[model samples]
Structures are given as C-alpha cells and as structure tokens.
Target: MQTEKITSLQVAQRAGVSQSAVSRVFTPGASASAKTVAKVKKAATELGYRPNMMARAMITGKSRIIGLVVAYLDNQFYPLALERLSNALQAQGYHILVFTSSNAQDRIAEVISDLLDYQVDGIITASVGMTNDLTARCETAGIPVVMFNRGQDDAAVGSVTSANVAGGRKVAEFFVSCGHKRIAHIAGWAGSSTGRDRARGFAEGLAAAGMKPLAVIDGHYDRSIAAQVTRDLMARSDPPDAIFVGNDHMAFAVLDTLRHELGLRVPQDVAVIGYDDVPLAAWPAFSLSTVRQPLNRMVDATLDMLLAQIAQGEIAPRRIEFDGPLITRGTTLTPKGPKQ
Candidate 1:
C-alpha cells in the first residue's frame, strides 16, 4: 500500500487559513497570530504535516545552522561548555552541527571545508586554532567564525575565553603565599594560546616573587604525559614541593600518580594545584585546589559574539576575557581569609 505525503497547502485548507499562515506557524522565528498558530498546529497534527527545514533553507538562503568544531572532549570543561552552547543556540532557533578535528592543519582544513559545504550560518571553534588560510576561506564565503575558549593572533577572528593569564598568575601567587619554594609547573600544550598565556603569566608571577619554577615541562594536556612528568619531577634530587598543572584533567592524573604510584601524601609530601575547577575537582577523593574557569559566563559571551557576527555580517571581531576564581580544597593548605 502507498501513502501520500501531506503538504502545507492541504493543512491550510483544513485549518481554513492561508498557506502563508501555515508557513509562519511552522517556521522558527517567523511571526503568526495565536489563532492562526492554533489552527495551523491543530490542522498539522490531524494531517501529519511537517515543515522541511532543508527546503526552507534553499528558498531563504539561510540554513540556520551553526557548525561547532572542537579539538577534543577529554577535558570536562569542554563538555559542560558545549552543552550550554547547544542549549543557548537552540533557543535562538539555530541548531549546531558538531565536528571534531585534530590539531593538524590538514585535518582542520577538511573540517572547515565540510562546514562550508553544509552552508552553515556561522562557525564556532572550541579548543582549536584557525589558520590564516582557513580564516580567509571562511571570510570569503561570508561565514562568521568565533573561537570559544581559544584565542587567535589575528585580530579579525573573534574569541571568548577565561582570563587564562590572570588565572595562572593567581595560582602562582597562591603557591608563593603558602611558602612553597620549590614550585614546578606541568603546562598545557605550548602550541596553544591558552597554554602559552598561562605559562607566561605563571613565570612572570614567580619572577615578581624573586623565585622561579623548579622545572616547567609541557604536559601537552595529556593525562599520561602529565603523570610521567610528575614522576620525572619527583625523581629529581630537589623535587618540587608544589606543582601547578595547566588543567584539571591532567591534574587528576598527577594526583593519582602521587598517591597510588609514588605513595606520596598530597599537601603533606607534595601539594598540587590545577586550573579549570571542573566538577570532579570538588569530589572528596580529589578535593583539588584549582582556578575555576567561568564556564557559563564564557559560554554566554561566546553566544553573544557569535550571534552578533551572524546578525551584523562582518562586524569588527571581539576578544572577550572573563576572570576566573581560585578555589582551595583539600589538595592545598588553606590560607587564612577567603579562598584565593
């Protein structure tokens, strides 16, 4: 048996309304009166008619889709941020198409090409870099791009991120205030702006205190690498009394290594601090002292910048940075006053 598909024309006839009225009811961000909307919806339910977004996009030349590219979701901070971003975009009548890419230039180019092919209204990249060539391509295509939790050297590209440099400096200040002389840092990937800014700020802060890190190793934002770095650091004749890891994801691995493999007591033998106060940091097992990235605020800022670009079409790019707070927990000795 064959069944015919119901159309908006039929729905309008059944509801005793114009075909345009039925369209307004079905199209997101379109206007329609309450009576017309009620009638169209009722008629649509009865006839099992649904709007085809693809066809509408073809006619309107707007897909209402935002392509989101992320480097990796291994970090807890990213998953939470992505959820908030998705919800906020959906509320604004835009849907997200997520694509994951490696740090490689070729892979990122492929991802950008895919986004352009899809005719995405805009693009948001999380924890990924946009090369000048790729940026040129997107600009030529008239697709606005915003970087979330990442910054680019190109002033033309928009970015929203936590005050990573300030956050790193804060951690250093906290460690120094605690009287930790032999301090070391397990830095994030030096290739990233976030990592570079944080490391630079940490070094500057330590220098201001007339002290320097025992060792600064690039963890590359990997758990296993961080764990190995922890071992290598501890094996030194004069090991670090305190270590500040670039992120909570790697910090967890550092904590595990200190406790399980090295049989070291946290804050007793070695105190550890990390950036990005993810949910797991608060757990009793870790109780990690960390700098909290203002995830919600950052997400909101990203949405605002992205939507503005989409609306204004090639407006000046924005660089937004929000300060993060330092949270002290069991992993570090609490200082007198409020948490740093």
Candidate 2:
C-alpha cells in the first residue's frame, strides 16, 4: 500500500499562517515570531510533517553538516575529544558526518573526496594528513578544512594543537630538577608533527640543561612496540634512570613492562612521564605523571575556527596552539614548586 506524505502547505493552512512562516519555523537560523512558531510547530506535530533535509538543502544550498575525519580512536583522549566536538556542533544547530580514514594517503584521499560529493559545509580531520592535490580540490570546491591535533606544512590548511614542544621541555625540566642524569624517551610515530616536535623539544631541553638522552626509541604510538622498546632500553648496559613516553596510551604499556616484566620499582628504580594525561593515568594502579593536553579548550578552539570559515569567505589559514601543563603524580620525583 502507498501512503501520501504531508506537505508544508497543509501545516501552514492548519496553523492559519503563510507557507513562508511555516518555512521559517522549520529552518534553522531563520527568524519567526514566538506565536507563529508555536502555531506552526503545533500544526506540524498534529500532521506529522517532517522536514526533508535533502529538499531543504537543495533550496538553501546549506546542509548544515560538517564532515569529521579521524584516523585513530585507540587513544582515550581522541574519543573524549570527539564527544566534545559532537556536542558543541549540535548546540550550534549543525550536524556531523563522520568518516574513518586510515594512515594511508590513498584511503584518506578517497574519504575526503566522498565528503566533498556530499556537499559538507566544512571538514575537521584528526590525526590525518591531506596531500596538496587534495587540498587544491577542496579549495576549488570552496570547502574549508581544519586539522585537529595534527599539522601540515601547507599554508592553505588550518590546524589546532597543544604546544607539544613546550610540553616536552617541561618534562625534561622536571627530570633534571629531580636529579635524573640517565634519561631516555620512547618517541611517538616519527612521521607525525606532534611526535617530531615533542622529540626535538625534549632533546633541545636536555641539551640546554647540560644533559643528553641515553637513548631515543621510536614507539610509533604502538603499545606492544613501546613495551618491547622499554624492555630493550632496560637491557642496555647503562640503563636510563628515567624515561619520558610520548603519550599516556603507550605509557601504560611502558609502565607495565617496566614494573611487571622487568620487576622494576617506579621512581625508586626508574621514573616515567608521558604526554596526554588521559583518565587512565589517574587510576590508582598507574598514578602516572604526565602532561595534560587541554581537550576542552582545544575542542572549543577548533569549532571557533571552523565556524569562522563557514561564515566568512575562506581566508588565510591559521594555526592555533594551546598550552598544556604537566601534572605530577607518583611516577616521578616531586619538584620544589607545586605542579601546574
């Protein structure tokens, strides 16, 4: 059996308002008085008149949808950030279309091309890189793209990230103040800007303090790999007294391997610090000392940048970096001043 669908005109007739008023009541960011809005909504409720987003989009040239691309969700920080971003977008009367992309450039290009076909208002990519050709296509289509927790050399793209360099330096300062001479760092994926920046800063900070890392092993942001590296670092003839891991996700593995497998005591035998103070870091079992990336602030900043582009014509791309504070816990020796 076939059924007829209700139209906006019928609701307008029932509410004793014009079709234009009915349209305003249904459209987001459109203006209608309270009485008219109430009457139109009441009529719509009685008639079960649902707005067709596809038709509306055709008329207004706006889908009110932003495409979000993410490479990895393994880290707790990313999941939390995604939730915050979704909520913030919803509050602004916008919707999200999520696409998962792998680290592979070809897969990322395909996902982005699909997003463009859907006519998304904007895009936000987390931990994914875009090629110059893809960037040119997006520019030609007049779609603004913002990278979150990632960086690109292209000036046409925008990004928001914590000051990884400063965060790394802070960790080095803490280790030096705590009198740890033999320090090493289990680095994140060397390909990532966040990873490279953090490693460079840590090394420079150590050098400035008249200290050099005993070893710097690339963990590639993998738990099993980081654990294996930690074991290898321990087996060295002159083992490190302290280690700074790139992120909390891998730090847990490093901590577990050092304590359980190697039978080493934290702080007493080997101190550990990590980046991204995820909730797991606070668990009684770990009590990890780490640098805290301000997720809420980062999310807010990302949205602001995205919306500004959506409002104004695409302007010069800008990069915003927020400051992250080091949170000291049981894993590292306490410094003289109060932890930030």
The positional error of residue 9 in candidate 1, measured at the CA in angstroms, is 1.3
lDDT of 2: 0.92
- What does candidate 1 score on TM? 0.96
Model 2 misplaced regions, further than 4 Å = 336-340
TM-score of each predicted structure versus truth: 0.96, 0.95
Query: Each model's RMSD to truth, in Å?
Result: 2.2, 2.4
lDDT, residue 265, model 1 = 96
Q: What tens digits encode model 1's per-residue C-alpha lDDT throughout 1-340?
A: 8788899999999999999998889788899999999989999999988888888889998899999999999999889888999999999999999999989999999999999999999999999999999999999999999999889899879999889999889988998888789999999999999998999889889999999888899999999999999999999999999999999999999999999999999998899999999999999999999999988889888888888888888589989999989999999975546677
Count clashing pairs, candidate 1.
Answer: 0
Across residues 34-84, which tens digit of lDDT does each residue of candidate 2 receive?
A: 999999999999998998887887888888999999988998888888899
Off by over 4 Å in 1: 336-340
- Evaluate candidate 2 by giving its C-alpha RMSD to the native, one decimal: 2.4
